[model samples]
Target: MLCPCRGKLKLLVVSLSFVILFTWLYLLVGNSENGRSLLLSACLVESTEARLLERDVLASRVREVEEENRQIRLQLSQSQGLAAQPVEGNYGNQQWVASADTGPEDAENTAEERANHSECSRSPTAEKCELIHVACVCAGHNASRDVVTLVKSILFHRRNPLHFHFITDTVANQILSTLFQSWMVPSVQVSFYDADELKSEVSWIPNKHYSGIYGLMKLTLTKALPSNLSKVIVLDTDITFATDIAELWAIFRKFTGNQKQVIGLVENQSDWYLGNLWKNHKPWPALGRGFNTGVILLYLERLRRIGWEQMWRLTAERELMSMLSTSLADQDIFNAFIKQNPVLVHQLPCFWNVQLSDHTRSEQCYTEVSDLKVIHWNSPKKLRVKNKHVEFFRNLYLTFLEYDGNLLRRELFGCPSQASSESTVLQHALEELDEDDQCYDFRRERIMVHRVHLYFLQYEYTPTDDGTDITLVAQLSMDRLQMLEAICKHWEGPISLALYMSDAEAQQFLRYAQASEVLKNRKNVGYHIVYKEGQFYPVNLVRNVALRNVNTPYVFLTDVDFLPMYGLYDYLRKSIVQLDMASTKKALVVPAFETLRYRLSFPKSKAELLSMLDMGTLYTFRYHVWTKGHAPTNYAKWRTATTPYKVEWEADFEPYVVVRRDCPEYDHRFVGFGWNKVSHIMELDAQEYDFIVLPNAFMIHMPHAPSFDISKFRSSPSYRYCLTTLKDEFHQDLSRKYGSAALKYLTAQRNI
Candidate 1:
């Protein structure tokens, strides 16, 4: 009954379907195993070629490394003025300048060093003189200057007649030198070398801090000091001084002619930093030695007799050849001299050269030794510390004092005052810090900790076999509870801490609300645990929970991921009370944050890619460096310099942050974590909490949020991770050091 056309159409449809079915079958039938095996075979053949290429690359790398070693050996030979020795070199060319230049950590402006830096009078009423002859060094954003200042403060502030012989590369300074010179009937003889005098002789690439820089300054100081002068304290500019300068002078005076030599303080008794320059490649630091350059009390007579100045100058000159390869400068000469017993060495009080923003503040507070002579602000946060208003003002004023008459006559008294209307406007932005800020004695004063603490929030989400989001909630709860216990047990002050735990876990961790006596007797550790069961908890809820919990006099909300170092208790106890802002009493007390297992190197194959990733944007998701927590509070625009979000910037774990108690506890208006942040924190009491973040203790994250690859962490205490040569512990003689406590602990943890 069907028409001929309809029958044909049906037949065509069936035939097309059959063809498609047969083709699919053909594809499925051939490769089932055999086709795959063939493809894999071809892949293996191609991979063999790849392996060959990799081998060639590796062989090329080995040759390149060998060449680099040759160059380094050559330079070291030239420095020592010896025939090139092939006894395998360690600090090859590229690692030469790897030494950090940010200066000493918690570097104090001691009265001793301050006495020599006479331009700035600490207090008008305070007696500012001590009879210490000189302590000199050149510092370009380093801890060495801090050490100098600390010694100066102790020596001079108490009215002891002290002359801090500062030989700076910066020749023209007015505020620190001339301004203060105008104020006092005092003598702080600052002998700043004319940069122009050596400009022609200096190489294209000038040496950074501590690079034969010390050696050059030493030479200059030797010439400047009187020939009869018995001694000189040659600090590298990073030490802190808490004790009187007279004590150190006494130590020098007590030493008989038979005893006095070049005295350098040593911190690490062992062959420390063995692989730092060599990167665990081999035969490093073993080629030389290690010692702390914080303070070096030199017997100038011995120095002159030994031609120490010549030694430093020659070494500095040789360092110029292989500039890119070396990380350390004058430190190397110090090591070589010390090794030969050319100078006497002494171990000073640990606190005198204490690394500022250290973790062990609590333990350090009780150690009864000389007051901190120099605070070495040596950690990574030197720039941040320098950015402080107090430090900035003081440094700016000092720079002006140290300003050369020529530059000032041209800039200040000449045509335009740098402190102009535009500059005044820039002051609020911290854009022109050098223009307006006044100089002061930043070290002699101790920072005080208030009653409020800002505890940050953290979460780790890992779905189980059941695919429930609740796993994260449990971890957050347990960690928060642990933090509470730790605070209750260790924290000495009455603090109100706010926490922002996200409800990423579907499981309700709040069930254990009263499990731990979070604050114990303390009233301020606020309990604002935010948990959203199935969905991402609204950022509003996260903040609100913290806001409602703060009932104490002050409040700060921070993350739970931070593990405080030993000194945190004291740092908080002391630094918090120093804040001049009103929020010091009611605003956020943001503590410092540092990451554990931080490494600078990445996979070569993925270098550009990782760079693209790490250089990602904060709020703009397109750029790869954007971490989850970098977004604005209300998802507002970024690049607002004065905003709280921008103000909160630091290299450490900012996500695990802190906030003030009086600031809006929670901005519930925003649905998620980052919204309404800048306006709320900065705009609300912009002047107060805006600058609340302080560089105190280094809070280490044991198992931090946004976890990283664990396998990559060092299996040993090798400093090779940061070095260029991939050297393990440098000294070949240190066979037993491999089994040290630190290495053992690392191994145990890796096994765990």
Candidate 2:
């Protein structure tokens, strides 16, 4: 073995020596291409790993953004519930409202993070408390109007320190900034934000028309809202506050013990999920279930911990984007995720989001409307119709705008105090209006008035044969000449214009009537100008005068501001001709719409008016009283749909009426704003007359900004005298007629 090892060692040494010599030679003179190839291989291997790492980092960032979007949307959809419901709290007393801070900014706040939020408001002192962040997504003029009204309600009720986060576009930001700067709430700090900052986070989110892009902003709230703000309350634009919102903020305390419940919101009190549309949607709960996000309360700290990112992952996996309904949009997506994780939700009271959509549903859930803390007008009808609820809320909302304006004027120009009188504020507003007039004045208002004037005043009214099917009668002053012109121009048949004007106004109208080509040329039109000597215009008496002037077999009594729906005359002519004039005492009640924008030409058809309504160019005025069986039927049921639906008259409504014979004469008693027209409707209802709502025969009320001087009418001595006389006359008429049985029909609100 040793001999063989020695021989092998000698051979191995020789071989190793030769190998070393060859390796040295190869290293010294290797092929250049082979060396380059070996170096390239090493670089490619390292580069491939770097590329993979970079791709992963980019992908992770994208995923994070998507997750952020999901979270923000979830927060937004639920935030509306925040202020929708509030408990009676320490700040519920009127003392808090009185002690509320009225300054531009809160300077004494030292609130820490979400962990120490409760400590931030250790005292009732409004200044030293940390401002709770409240976010709302508002865009465009209408939405901005809503936000202004909403914030006004919030600040008006909340004496607690708060900051308003207005998520809006650049233009909306400027508008909201200017509007909020006027509010003198030191406890309130307003910050405007653009979704553009977080838009990239939701880049993968769908941009559908049903929900729009603003709805997506709520999805990024976890990252978008200031990190310093550990909690937030979100509200819808349509919400009205009736209680202290600080009580709403305190609700976060209820969520403290629960790990899964990060959102507190009101349930959909209406039959939102009751229809078959949601039957197949397994994610949807039982009928009359689910929540309305009109108002939501979010615990930001807890929301951050929740795996909201799973929304995106599941959405992708289930292909829900393509499967979901556009009508529900983000709301549907949120419901889908939360349905499986009910523990994450905090069910609030139905009164929180008092659904003012369907009365049946609203009654079923939120029975006590007066007890409701937040009124959520959830009906799409709210967008177009100024019903009783809308009217009440709208006026209340306008009060806030008026307050904001007055405060702004006071703070900026050092104007006189607004606490003086209504007239004083009116004067200040008038002065401001004058100042606005002096700027690069784009008189959209003046242009609109002029357009209406030209359309109504100049449209030629040609007489028709058959003595005009129905006489269109109206009572007016020279102030309503534009309206008269529109009615005269639009009414296809005979018209009766009964003017209750001053001597000067009568002369003014006489001059125009004699010179006007349209009015002067019409043969079938009748003009009765009765000059009035007093300041008070007896609206009912004047209407009676107009009604008495009707010469045709059938008469349609309406206001000067009302014009028949296009082609209504021909439809009425045909329909009335077919009726048994001797026996049929049918009273036709037609739907009325308020024109939202200035139109140079009248709507040619009801379809045209409806199209404008859908386009947001027109809106429906308050006909709420009509829906409570106060009228024959709720025209809203098919107001824009089918035609010629018969409805039994239950109670009287307004001046809108059509009668041939046997109908009671105008009361000639009720006076002032709204007057007592319902009494006449009651008389007709008692007579057992047939009521029909003509879908095709509608009226379009022209928009007008009546002078603020209309308010002065109530205080006028002449008006008071007229009211007394009318009240006495109404009492005598009721006593002489059906006794107190018809007393309920009187305009009791006026106590006349």
lDDT of 2 by residue, 318-413 (tens): 544555332454455555555665667765555566667653244444323454567776667763443445565555545554343222222212
| lDDT score at residue 644, model 2, on the 0-100 scale | 70
- Which consecutive 10 residues in model 2 have the weakest lDDT in total? 446-455
Candidates in order, TM-scores: namely: 0.30, 0.38
Q: Return model 1's CA RMSD, one decimal.
A: 36.5
lDDT of 1 by residue, 111-163 (tens): 12322222111112312333456555543323221432344344333334445
Q: What is the lDDT of residue 350 in candidate 2?
A: 54
lDDT of each: 0.37, 0.56
